[model samples]
Target: MNPIDPQLPPGDPLVMLGLLASAILFAVGIVGFLSRRNMITMFLCTELMFQGAGLAMISYGRQHMDLSGQVFVIFILTVAAAEAALALGLVVLLYRRKETLSAEAWKELAES
Candidate 1:
């Protein structure tokens, strides 16, 4: 009993849809990264990029029936968690110093 019906051939529509979704997510992330002035929003955009990467990886893994891609996604998620922690810390520090969360406020560091 082959699970995929062995004779029907592999349907790739899911893979294509996953790729398309990943592309959309990546594009949105890029746009947000470029246009947003809030540090929290920027960090969220970065996370969106990571999520897109993870989706792409999982889709690839499913298409190939391999575990390595999923393992890579796990590693990416771990790194993303660490990045979020660091980014939140920076946000708190910046807010304390500037009393604002706008990206423009970061220029204060440059002048000093």
Candidate 2:
């Protein structure tokens, strides 16, 4: 019987490492999103989630030899940029109103 090679090829190792990093980033983002009450921390967690998604997409693209995954990553980056802009605007508005950046202090809205 022939034994399979224990060492992974270069591509395989890179894919495995990317997947592991994505998983860790996802886990940490989830934890931060749930545990933090600050708006900035929540925003950071969202960015982390975006990063993990991008990593997974890039890894899959490499494995498949396709450009679609990279295109998707580009779209994700665009969306993340928009999200950051909007979030910062809202944070500024909130700070102006409450003089604080805590999530708990953002209960009232301009309409109410």
TM-score of 1: 0.85
Name the best candidate (by TM-score).
1
What overall lDDT goes with each candidate model? 0.90, 0.87
- List clashing residue pairs in candidate 2: none
TM-score of each: 0.85, 0.82
TM-score of 2: 0.82
List where candidate 2 sits over 4 angstroms from the true fold: 1-11, 107-112
**Tens-digit lDDT track for model 2 on 3-96?**
6676954457787788788888988999999889888889999999999999989888878889998999999999999999999899889889
Evaluate residue 55 in candidate 1 and report its C-alpha lDDT on the 0 to 100 scale.
87
Looking at candidate 1, the ten consecutive residues that score lowest on lDDT are: 1-10
Highest lDDT against the true fold, candidate: 1
Q: What value does the lDDT take at residue 29 in candidate 2? A: 92
Evaluated at residue 54, the lDDT of candidate 1 is 87
Clashes of 1: 0
